[model samples]
Target: MRARLELFASIRRDARIEGLSIRGLAKRYQVGRDTVRQALSDPVPPARKTPVRSSPRLDPFKPAIDAMLVEDTTAPRKQRHTARRILARLIEEHDALELSYSTVRDYVRVRRAQIDVEAGRRVEVFVPQEHAPGAEAEVDFGEVWIVLDGVKTKCHMFIFRLSHSGKAIHRVYPTQAQEAFLEGHIEAFNEIGGVPVKHIRYDNLTSAVRTVVFGQGRNRVENDRWVLFRSFYGFDSFYCQPGIAGAHEKGGVEGEVGWFRRNRLTPMPVAKSLEELNDRIRYREAEDDQRRFDGRIRTIGHDFAAERPFLAPLPAEEFDPGLVLNPRVDRSSMITVRMVKYSVPARFIGRRVRVSLRASELVVFDGRAVAARHQRIVAKGGQSVQLDHYLEVLKTKPGALPGSTALARARASGSFTSAHEAFWAASRRVNGDAEGTRELIDVLLLHRSMDAADIQAGITAALRVGAVSADVVAVEARRHATTSAAEGGPRSDRHRGAHAQAKVQRVVSLTQRRLMDPAAVIAGLPSDSRPLPSVRAYDELLAKRAEHPAKTASKENIS
Candidate 1:
C-alpha cells in the first residue's frame, strides 16, 4: 500500500511538472482513471474491508450452541462437546433441519473461542526451574526404529539428562527389558563419572515400579532391584504421577529423548551392528558437549565441568547390572534364557548352570568357573551355539557333526574357516567318514589350548605340504603355538607356567607320531636290490681259501 501511495504521488508530481492528463497518469501507473483521481484527492490508499458473513441457516440453533459452549468451560476437558458432536445433537433434538453442517461448524468454531476466552481458559504457564549442580536428573525410555545391516530393526533408547548442565546420554538397546534398564543407569553413571543430585526422577516404569498405588500421591511400591540399585549408588528415587500428569515431572529427559532423536537419529541411522550404533551414539554425546542448551550462558562442557565437582563421587566399585538365572542345560546341551537358546558344554547336560544375562552377552557359570560366554540373541527361537561345547559329544556321534547348529554357526562366524573345511575334506578322503570326523574333533579341541589364528595358520601350513592327517595338523598347529608362546616371552605366574607346560606337552605328544605314509615312503625305492647270494658261492670261497690260505690272507688284508 505504501509503495502504491509513493507511486501515485510520483505520478501526480510528474503530471504537474510535464503537464500530463489524468488518463495518461492512470496508464503510467497501471491504474483506472477513477483510481488516479482518488489517489490525487487522498494521499493514502483506502483500507480493505473484510466480507461480512452470516450463518442465517444456523440462527435458530445459535442459542443451543452458545449454551453448550458456555457449559463446556465448567465441564471435564475431555468430556467437552466437539463440533461434530454438537452438530449431531443439534440435528437430533433441536430440529435444526434447515441448517447446513458448515453453517453450524463455522459458528461453533468462532463461538467456542469467544466462550473459552470469556470463561478464562488460556495457555498453560510453567515456572522457570533452577536446579542445583549435580542435584537433579531425569530418566526416560523412547522407541527408535533403525535399519541394521539392511534389515529394519526396532530398538529402545534410554535417555538420561542432568537437570543443571543439560548434558544428556543416549544409549540404545534391543529391548526395554529390566536388565537394559539397569544397564543403562550403570553405563550413564560410568560415562558421566558421577551420580546426579541426590534425587533422580523417573516415570513409573514397570522396571522400577512394582505396583502403582491408586488414590495415592506419587506413593508406590518399587521393584526390589530398583531399590537395591539406588541404594548402591547412594541416590533417591522419585516417581512421577501416573499418565499425562507425570510427564512434566521428568520433563527434561522427556524432551531430551525426542530432541536427540530429531537432531542425531533422524532419517533412521544405519549401522552394521548395535555395538557400532552405540559407539556412534557415544561419540555424538561427546560432540554435543561443545553445545549449550537454550537460555544457558555456558556450553554443556563448561556447565558439566562446574557441576562435576559437586556430583556424588563414584562408588568404589561399579554395580553389576546383569540378571542371574539358573537354567538347566537341555538334552541338546543348551540353556534357554529370554526364549533364546545358548549351548553350554555337553557335559553340563541335565545339570543346572548359573547364567548371567547382560544386555548383549550371556555368561554361563559352573561352580565358580565360567563355563561359556555367548553374544545374547534377541530374536525369538534364535540360538547361539559354540561348536567347542559339543565337540565331546560329536566325537562319539560324528554323523551329527555335519548338520549341527553349532557347526553351522561356527562356519558362519569364520571360526571354522576354509582351513577347517580343507582339513575335513582331506581327512574324509584319507580316512573313513567316522574316523575323519573324530580326527577333526580332535583338531577342534585344540582351540581350547591354542589361539584360533595359530591353529588356522598351522592348518594352512600342513595343507600346503599335502598332509591331511589329524596328527600332521596337530603338529603344525602346535609348532605355531609354541613359537607364539616363545615370542610372547616367558611368564612366571603359576597358572600361566602350568598352561605353557601343558601346551608344550600337547605339541610334543602330537609330533611323536609319524606324519608321512609308510607306503608313500617306500614307493620310490628300487625293487630288485637283493643280491643272488648262494650256498655255492660260500663253498667256492672256502675251497680257494684252503688252496691259498696265505694268498687269501694277504688278499683279505689288502681288501
Candidate 2:
C-alpha cells in the first residue's frame, strides 16, 4: 500500500513540473491512464490491504493460556509465561503440533481481549443475594498505620456494612478501647442513616468477646457499660469464631475491610494527628460509597440512599459515652480520678463523690454546680486525681488543722495548732517560766467553743496583774472558778484569796521599790510642802503628816 501510494504521488508531481499529459505520464510510469488521471486530480488516495489474522494452527494452545489467566488473577503479568515459552512448551510436549513463535505471539495478541492486562488477569465479580431492608450488617476492625504528631502509630479501622446496599461506614481510632468500638458503631449507624434491625456480625474482638469457647459455645462477653450502651441503642451482636476460617461467615465486612483499606486509604495517607487521620479516613470512606464498585450498577452510596429509610430511627436519647464511678474523698478532702485530684466542698469529706468520667473530662458535682473538672487521668487507684473541692473549708475553719493519722494520734506531739507561729510563741514563754502565758493560751484554746470576748477578757486580766505566768493565770482562773467562767464572772474564794495575795505582793513589792527608787515615791508627794525634806527627815515628816493637817501645822508653829 505504501509503495502504490508513493508511486502515484511521484508521477503526479512529475507531470505538473514537466507539463507532461496525464495519459503520457501513465504510459511513462507503466500504469493505467485512469490511474494517472485520478492521481493528477487528487493529491492523495487511501491505501488498501488484505486483513491478516492469526491462524488457528499458530495458537492451538490459546485455550490453555486463557484458562490459566482466568484462574490466577492475582499472579503477576511477567510471571504469566511469554508466548515463546508457551509455543516451545507446546512443541516439546506434542510433536504433532506445529506453530512458530511469531504465530504464537500473534495468537496471544488477538486473544488479548480475554486477558485483563491491567490486573494481570480477570477477577470474578462478587454478587450478594438481595437482602431485606433492615436485615443485617457486617462489622469488622482493620488496621492502619499513620503518623500522629510525627510519631508512627497503628490505628484500628472500624468498618460497618449494610447487607442490602453494601454501603460502608468506617472510622480510625488511636485505640481499640470498648468505648471507641461502641462509639464507632453509633457514628456508623448515623452515617448509614439508621440502625439495622438485624444482627451485626463481628470478629472475636476482646471488645465484644471476653472468651472464645470452643464447641461448648462462644461467649458473647463484653464490657458491662458496653452492653448497656448497646441495649440502649437496640441491636443484637453476632460474633464470629476466633479464626481466619470463620471470616467466611461474615464475608461482607471481611471483604469491606480489605476493600476500604485498598480503595479509601490508597497512596499511603499522612496526617498530622490521629484525629486528623480519622477525619481523612471518614471522608474517603464516604467518597468510596459514592464511587462505583466493580464499575457496575448503582454506587454504594446510591443503594444506601434507598435502603436508609428502612433502618430503625436513632433513639430519642443518645448514648452517653461516659463511665460513672463512686470515689471517696480522702482526708485531704479531694478525690483522685485519672491521676488528677479534684477538690469537693469540705463538708463532703469522708463521703463518696459520684464521678462522671468522659473521654476528655472528669467532672464531679456537689448536687449543684460542678465541684471540680479535670483533664481525665486514666490511671487506677494509688494514682490519684487531685480536686480542689472543700479547700474553702480550710479558709473558714482555719484551726481544723492538718496532719497524718499518726500525728493526730500523738496529741502531745505538739502539732496542736494550725497556727504554728502562735503555738511556738506560747511554747517558748511557757518554757521561760511564764506559765501564766501558757495558761492564757490554754484558756484561749478552750474558747474553741467560746466567744472571743471571753478569751480577750481572760487575757486582759492576766496582763493587768503582770502575773502573766501560765501558773499565775491558772491561779486566777481557779480563784474565779465560781464565776460563769466567762470574761465577767463573780470572784470565787480561791479568786479572792489569790487576789489578796496578789495585793499583798504588790504592797511588799512597792515598799521594796522605796529602797530602790525613792525619787519615784518623792515625786508622788502631795501638793503641800511645809518642811524641807531629806532621806533621814522623811520619817519625821511622815510623823508630822500623820497628825491632822491643821493641828500639825499649828503645833509646829507654836513649837
Candidate 3:
C-alpha cells in the first residue's frame, strides 16, 4: 500500500508540477500510460474494490438467513439453529432455495456478525444519573486475593462509595458473614460521619435480603436485623435485581472495589497481621484523598468536604453490630462461635452461655457477669483459651499444666513472664515438678486481682532472697504494689499500725537525706591518713627570673 501510494503521489506531482504528458510520465516511471493517467486524474491512490459476483442460489435465501440471525438474539442460546441446520432448513423447508452447505456456511458467517451488531445497538441502555451530594451511596462486597503475612489468602472486601463525590471506604474481612456485613456498614458510616439521606443502593446480598420476589419490582423480604440497622441509620434502601444483572444498581462500589484493589492492593500487600494490613489500607485511603477521578473537576476529599454538611446527622448512639449466639460450653470449657472455639470459665461447662460475637472480639456472658472475652479467631476450628478461665481445672489437674493451651497463651502474651518461669523452676527443684506447677498456678491466680508485672516483680524479689514459696511471692508482690501506690502521690487513707510507722520512717529518712549537703557528709567521713605538703620550688624559680630579666637577656645573647 505504501509503495503504490508513493508511486501515485510521485506521478501526480510530476504530471502537475513538471506539466508532463501521461505518455511521458509512464515512460519515466516504467509504467503503462493508463496507470499514469489514473494517478493524474486522482491525487489520492484509489482503494481496491471487491469484485461483485452473482451467487444465484444463495442470493435468494439471504433474507431468510438474516431473519434467523436476528431472531436468535431473543432465542435460548442452545436452542438457536446452527449453520448446518439453517442450510438443511433452507433446502428442505424452502424448496426454491438451492445452495450447498459450504456456500451457505461462508455467507452466514459474515451475515450473522452483522445481525449481532444490529441487535447490540438496539439492546437496553442506561441513562447517566446525576447524584446529589450526601443523598445517595452504594454498598457492595467484592472478593480480593491478597498475600497476607506471606500466605496467599482470599478475603472479602466491603466497599462503600458515596455516589456524588466518588469517595469510598473499603475494609477487608475473612468472611462475608452477617456480622461482618453489619459491622462494615457501622464502620463505614462512622468514617463517613453521616448517612446518605435518600437511599443507599445494595445488591440482593443474603446478609440484607431474606428473599427476592421474581417479577416483583424492587419488592423483596429483607433481613430482620438488617431492617433494624437501616431503621437506626434513618436511610432507605434500594435493592438491585439479583445476580450479575443487578450489579449495575450499586455500580459505584462495584467499580471501586476493582479500582482500589488495582491501585492500592496490587503487587500483593505483605503484612505481619491483619491489623497491619488494615493500617496500610488506612494510609492508602488518605493518599487516595488527594486524587481526582476522571471527568471530575474536584478531588474526592474536596467534594466530600462540601457534601459532608448536607449528610444526615448521626444517631445518638451506635448500633450494636454483634451477632448473638447461645452455644453450650463443652466439657473442655470451650464454646464454639463461628466454627472457632473459645474457652470460658470451667464452671460454665455443660451449660449454655450467651456469646456476643463482634467482628474482632467475642464476649461470653454467664447471665449478667461476663465470663470471658477473646479476640475473635478468623480460622475455623482454632481455639483461644484463657489460662485464667482454666485455673480452677488446672488446680485439680496439675499434670495437665505442661501442655495446656492456656499456659501457652499466657507465655506468648508475657502474662507469665520469665520471672514466673524462674520461680517455677526453683520451686520444682525444691518441691518436685507437680507440686511446683500447682504452686505456680496458685501464683497465676493472683493475676486475676493484681497486675501481672507487679506479681512478676514480686516473684523476682522473692527469688532474690532465695524464697520459692507462693506465700513469699504473694507478700513480695503486695509489698511492692503498696510501695508503688504510696510513692505515686499522697496516701488516700492513712495507716495507723506498724506498717504505717515503717512508711512514715522511710519518708523521714528520705527527707533527712535530701536536707543534708554532700560536701558536709564527705567531710564527716573518717580519713585513713594525712597527706604530706609539696615544696614551692617552681614559684621561687619564677621570682628569681622576674628580678634578673635584663641581665639574663644579655648573658643569653653573649652565649
Candidate 4:
C-alpha cells in the first residue's frame, strides 16, 4: 500500500512539475500507460473486483434450486428443504453430478438473503436503539420444567423486563392460559411498582391477540379481556410480528428468559407445589436487580431506581386476575375444571358452583363464601380432593371411608395422622369393625372446628385413659382446644401426631403437670357443657343392695 501510494505521488508531482506526457510518465515509472493514466486520474485506486467464475456443470441446476427456494416461501418452516436436500435432488432428479453440497450450501446462503430482501420478507437488520426510562418493556413466555411434588412437570415461565433498566420479574405457571398471562402482568406491575409509561412489547401471543392482520402492517385484533385490562391499567400494547421473524422485537425479555433459565433455573428446581417453585423464581428476580448488564455503568437496580419515578402511577383499584367458571359438581363431589377434577364439599354436589380460577389455585364459592379451595391441578384427568369436603358423605357410608379417594389423599398428605389410625384400631378391638369405624368417622368430624394439633391431642388424651370411644375423644379434644384458646393458642409444641404412642409412653401425672406449669391448676379447661361422668353413683347403689338383702329375705318369708 505504501509503495503504491509513493508511486502515485511521485508520478503526480513529476507530471505537474515537468509537464510530462503519459508516455513519458509510463517510461519514467516503468509502468503501463493505463497504470500511469490511473495514477494521474485518481490519488487512490478503486478496490479490485473478483471476476465472475462460471460453473457450466452446475449452472443448469441453479434454476432448479432457485425454483425450490421459491417454493419454500409457502412451505411449512420446519419441513422446508436444506442445501444438502437440494444438492441430493439435483444429483438424483436432474443428474447434475458436478455439484457438491458445499457449492449448493454457499449459493443457497447468499440466494436466501437476496430472496428475502427482494421479497421484503425477512430482511434481517436491526438499528441500535436507545430506550427511554419507563417508556417500554417486553413480555415473553418460555417453557421450563420443574419437579412438582416428585412428578416431572412442564410449566410456562412468564417474564416481564424493563427495556431501559433490564430489571425483570419471572413467574411459573402450569399453563400459559389467559388468566396466567394477565395475572403475570399484574404481578410484574406491582413488583416493579408501576406500569411502563408507553407501550409494552409482545409477540402475537394468542392470549392477547385474537388475530394478526397478516401483512407488513402491525395490525392486530386483540382479546377483549386483554383490551379491557389494558384500559384498566392505562398502558398500550405493541404486538411484534409473529414467529422467529418477530423475536427481535421483544429481544430484551427473550434473552432474559433464556439467560435466567440457564444461569438460575438450570438444574431443574424441585418443589412441593407450583407456589413453592414460584417463590424460588421470585427471589431470583430480586437477586437479578443487582446485576449489571454488559457495557452499562449503572447496575440494573440503580438504573431502575432512577427509572421508577418516570413510570405511570398504578391504578387505585386492583384488577381481578382470575377467570370465573361455573362448573357443576359431579355426583363424586368433584367439579371438572380444564378437564381436571377438584373435590368440593359434598353439599355442593349436583349444583353449579362459581369457581374463580387463578394461575396457582381455584377457589370454589357457594353463594359468596368459599366452599373449598384447592391448588390448581395442572395435569389433565388429575384429581385433587380435601378429606374434609367429603366427611358428610362418609358419615352415612362408613364403609366407604376406608376405600374413598379422599381418605387415600388425606393419608398421603399426612393430614390423617397415625394417631387417628391408632385410635381407630383400639376402637375396633373394643367394639366391632362397623361400629368402631363409625366412631372413628365421628372423631374425624372434629377436624372441621378444631385445630389439627388440638384434635391430635384429644385423641392422645382418650387413648391414654383406655377410652376407646368417639364421645371420650370429643370431650378430651374440646378440653385441649379450650386450654389452647386460654393460653393464646400458641402451638410451640405442635406436631403431626404421627407418633401418638410417644405421648402415651411418657405419661405425666396431674401433680407433675401442675408443678411444670405455675399457672393455676384449677383453671385446667373452661367448664365443659356436658355433666361430669360418675361411676361412684353405681357403687353407692351396690352398697344399698347389700344392706337391703337381709330385709328382703324377711319379706320373702312373710309372703
Candidate 5:
C-alpha cells in the first residue's frame, strides 16, 4: 500500500496523464476497489530525486523572454502582445523553426517568475531617518466652500505642517493666484512664529513647476521671482511630481488639507463677506493648535512652541505680494493698468507711472501724495476714474499747467470740446494778441473758476474781431475808450483855448525850422539856433523905411 502512493505519484507526474480515477487505477493494478481507491486518494509525498531535464523549448530564449515579461507586467496588458510579436519575429527573421506560439507562451510564464524576483529587489533605496525639530515641513492646497457676501463660494485651502513637531497652520483664500500663494506662506510663517530649515515639500502645482521635462531627474521651476521670494523668506521648496502617486511625500499637509476643509468649512458655514469667512477660518485654525494627537503628550501649539527655537528668525521687512507694473499715461492723461484706466493729473500725461497692483484695489501716487484711487475692476479697456475728478484743481491755478501739450492732447482726445474752444476764444478777445489768447485760454480753463457763461462770451468776442492779433486788439481798445466829460465827468472846454494856442505856437515854430534846414527839419533838430524873421515882420520894416523916404532923399543929395 505504501508503494502504491509512489506509483500514483508517478502516474500523476506523467506528461501523458491528467486525473487518474480510483476505479480505473484499481482495474489496472488488479486490486480490490477499496484498496486501490485508498492508494489513489492518498496525497503524494516528494522523495529526494535528481532534477529532470529542463524544457528545450524554453531553454534557449529564457533570459530574453524573462526580461520582456518583467518589463511588460508594469506596462499595460495591450502592450504584452509585444512579447508574442517578438517571438514570431524571431521565427520569421532568424530561422527559429522549433519555437511555436504555445512554447513561447509557456516559456514566458516561467521566466516571469524570475523576472519578478529581480524587479522586486530593485526598489528605491531610502536613507535612514534622522528627525530634527523644525527641520522639514509639507505644504499643499485643497478646496472648501464657505458663505461669502451671503452667497456660498468655493475657496482654496492652504495647509502646512511641521514634520517633526506635527504643528500645522491652515488658511483659506478666494483665489489661488500666485500673490495669494506667497501671501499664504507669509501668514503661515507668522502663525508658526518661525521658518523651517529643511525643504518644504509640495505637489507640482503650477506655482512651483514651470515645465516638466520627461525622463529627467528634475523639472524647470518657476521664474526667479518665486525663487527670490523663497530666498528672501528663508526657506526652500521641494516639488513632487504632479499626481496622486507622487503626493505621498507631502502626506503631512495632504492630511491637514482635508482635515481643515472637513472640520472648519463643512456644515454650510455662513459669513457676511469673504473677509469675514477668512476671519472665521483663521480663528478655527488657531483653535486647532490647542488640540493633541493620539499618543502625543503635547498639543500642536506646544510642539510648535518647542520647534520655534530651531526655526530661522523672520526677516525685518514683510514680503510684498503686490505686482509692480509700469504703465505710461496715454495722451488722455489716463494710464491703463490691468485693463482698468486710471486718470492722473493731466500734467502726468505721456509720463510713465508705476502701478503697485493688489487684488482688490488700485492706488496711484504722484511722487508721494495719492494722485488717484479706485476699486479694482476686472474688465478690460475702460476708464476707472474720470477726468473731471481733478478738474477743480486744474482750474484754480491755470498756470500750474500740464502745459499746452497736455491741453492739446486733451482737446484732441475729445476731453476738451468745441465749447471749451469757444470759451478760450472769448478770453483771447478780453486779453488781445497771442498774450491775450494765452490769458483767454487761462480764463477758459476757469471752467473751474468764472461762470462757463462768462468764459463762453469772452471767447465769442475774441473770435469775432480778428483780435486774433494782440496788437490789433490794443488799437481797438483805444478807439473804444470812453471820456467822462459828456456825463458828470471832467470839464475840458476851459482848457481848450489854451490847448489850441499852445498847439498853433508849436506849429509856427516847426514850419520856420523846416524852411531854415529842410533835411535837419525832417530830422527834427532842436531849436537852439536864432529864429528867422517872419514875412509879416519884413513887410512892417519896409513900410517904416518908406516913411523915412524923405530922409533918404536928403542923404542921396549930400552924396
Candidate 6:
C-alpha cells in the first residue's frame, strides 16, 4: 500500500511539474499506460474491492440457518443448535441432501455471531465520564485470599474510591455483611475527612439493595438501615444496573479493587488477625499517594489535596454502625445473638441486656457502663466467654476453677500465665484447695484495679517472698505501680493504668497529692488577713456579767 501511494505521488508530481504525457510517464516508470493514467487521476491508491464469493452448496439453506440461529438465542443453552444438529435437521426435515456438515458448520459460526450482534447481545458502547472534583465516588467489595493466623482464609475487601482524584480506601473484613458495609463507609469518610458532595456509586449488593427493581432504570428497593445511613450522611446512592451490565457503571472502584488485590495483597498477605492486615493495607494505600493515574499530570495525593475542599464537610459525629440487640442472659451467663453466645457478668443471668453488635466486636452494656466486650464470633454456635465475666461465680464454686473452660481460655490467651498457675499451686499446697482457689481469685480481681504488667510483677514478688496472700500481692503491685509512675509518665502504671470511673484511683490519695505541692495549694486558698479567731470578746462579756450580778439581782427583786 505504501509503495503504490508513493508511486502515485511521484507520478502526479512529475506530471504537474515536468508536464509529462501519460505514455511518457509509463515508459519512464517501466509500467503500463493505464497505471500512469490511474496515478494521474488520484494521488492515493484506491482500496481494492473484494469480490463476494457464493456458497452455492449452502446458499439455499441460508434463510433456514438464520431462523435457527435466532431461535437459538432464546433456547436453553444446552439444547441450542450445533452445526451438526442444523445439518441433521436440514437433511431430515428439508431433505437437503446436497448440504455437507462442513458447509453448515462454517455458515453457523459467522451467522450466529452476526445474530448476537444484531440482537444487542455481543456489542456494547460506553460513554466517557468526567467526574467533578469530589462530586462522585464508588464502593464495592472484592474477594482476597490471605494467610490469617496460619490458616488460609478468604476475606472480603471493602473498596471506596474517588472517581476524580482516584484516592481510595481499602479495608479487609471477615465477611461482607451489612455491618462491615456501613462501617467501611464511615471509616472511609472519616479517613478522607469528608464525603462526596454528589453521590456514591455501588453495584446491587444485598447490604445496600434489598431488591433490584427492573425496567425502571436503576430503581431499587434499598435496605432500611442503608436508607437511614444514606440520610444521615446526606449523600445519594446511585446503584448500577444489575449483573454484568452494571460492572462498567462503577468501573473506577472495580478497577481499584483488582489493582489493590493484585499489587498490594499479592503473595496472599499473612497476618495474625484482620486488624493487623488492615494496618498493612492502610500503610500501602498511604504509600500509593505518590503514584499518578494514567494520563494524569499530578499524583493522586496532589489531586486529593486540591479536591478535599470541594467535598462536603464530614458530619459532627459519626453514626454508630452497629446493630443493637436485647438478648436475655441465660443460666450459662451467656446471651445468644444471631445464634452465637457471648458471656456477660453472671449477675446479669436471667435478665435482658443491651448489646451493640458491631462489625468486629460486640459490647454488652449494663446500663451506661460497658459490662463486657468481646471479639465477635464468626461461626454459628460459637461461644466467646471472658474469664473475668465468670470470676464472681468462680469465687463461690472454687472447685470449678480447676476444670473451667474460662480458665483454659485465659491460659491460652496469655492473660493467665505460668506465674499465675505457679502461684495458685503454691497457695493450694499451703492452704486447702478451696481456700487456695479463693485466694487466687482475689489476686485475679486485682487486674481490675492495676495494670497487667504491674499485677504480674506483684505476683512475682509475692511468690519470691513466700507470702502467698492476696493482700501481699496488692501491696507489691502498688509498689511496682508507684515505682513505674515515678520513672515514666504513667505509661506502665499508676493513675492512668488503674481502672477508675469517677476519678483516677491512685496508689495514694488526693491529700497526699496536695501535700506534694503545699505552696501552690496555699496560694490558691483565700488570704487570711484577719486576726486569729478570738475568745477575748466573750471573756469581756463574762467579766461584765460577773461585776453587775449583785445590782441585777437587787433590780430583779424590786421589779
Tens digits of per-residue lDDT, candidate 3, 18-119, equal 999988999999999888877878867778798987788787788988888888988996898788989888878788455788888888888877787778
Best by lDDT: 6
Instruction: State the lDDT at 60 in candidate 2.
Output: 55
RMSD of each: 10.1, 21.5, 21.0, 10.1, 25.9, 14.9
**In angstroms, how far off is 29's CA in candidate 2?**
30
Task: Score every model by TM-score.
Answer: 0.74, 0.42, 0.69, 0.70, 0.47, 0.75
Which has the better lDDT: candidate 3, or candidate 5?
A: 3
CA lDDT, every model vs. true structure: 0.82, 0.62, 0.81, 0.83, 0.63, 0.85
| Candidate 1 lDDT tens digits, 1-559 | 7787787688778777988889998888788888788777877877768899765677777889999999999999889998888988987998776776777777888889888888889845677788999999899999999998799999999988899999898898988888899999988898889997579898889999999989987788988988999889999988888888778877889889988999999999999888999999999998999997777788999999899888888899988788999998899999999898899998999999998898778889888899899987789999888999999888889999988888889988878888799778767766768988888899898888766876887777665555566676767766665565655634222234434443442222222112333332222334333454468757887777688778778888999
Residue 533 shift from truth in candidate 6, angstroms: 56
Which stretches in model 4 have alpha-carbon errors above 4 Å? 1-123, 431-435, 468-559
Ranking by lDDT: 6, 4, 1, 3, 5, 2
Residues 328-425, candidate 6: write the lDDT tens digits: 99998989998898888899989999898888889989899999999877789998877998889988999999888888889988899988998798
Q: Which residue runs does candidate 5 get wrong by more than 4 Å?
A: 1-74, 77-130, 213-216, 329-335, 340-351, 359-365, 368-559
Separate clash counts for every candidate: 2, 28, 0, 0, 9, 0
Candidate 3 wrong stretches, greater than 4 Å: 1-61, 81-122, 148-150, 367-369, 378-380, 409-419, 449-465, 469-559
As a TM-score, model 4 comes out at 0.70
* Superior by lDDT: candidate 4 or candidate 5: 4
Prediction 1 TM-score vs. true: 0.74
lDDT digits (tens) for residues 1-559 of candidate 4:
7788889999999999999999999998899999898899999965678899876777778889888888887789898889999998988999888778888898999897776666667655798888999999999999998888898889999999999999999999999999899999999999999999899999889999998897759989998889999999999999887788888888888899999999998899999987888888888878888888878888899999999999999999999878989999889988999999999988877899999998888998888888889888877899998988877777778788888889899999999999999888777766667777888988988887778887898888767655667777776776675555545567425433422422223222343222222332333344224444569768987888798998989999999
Runs of candidate 2 exceeding 4 Å displacement: 1-129, 216-227, 258-282, 329-351, 358-559
Looking at model 3, which ten-residue stretch has the lowest summed lDDT? 504-513
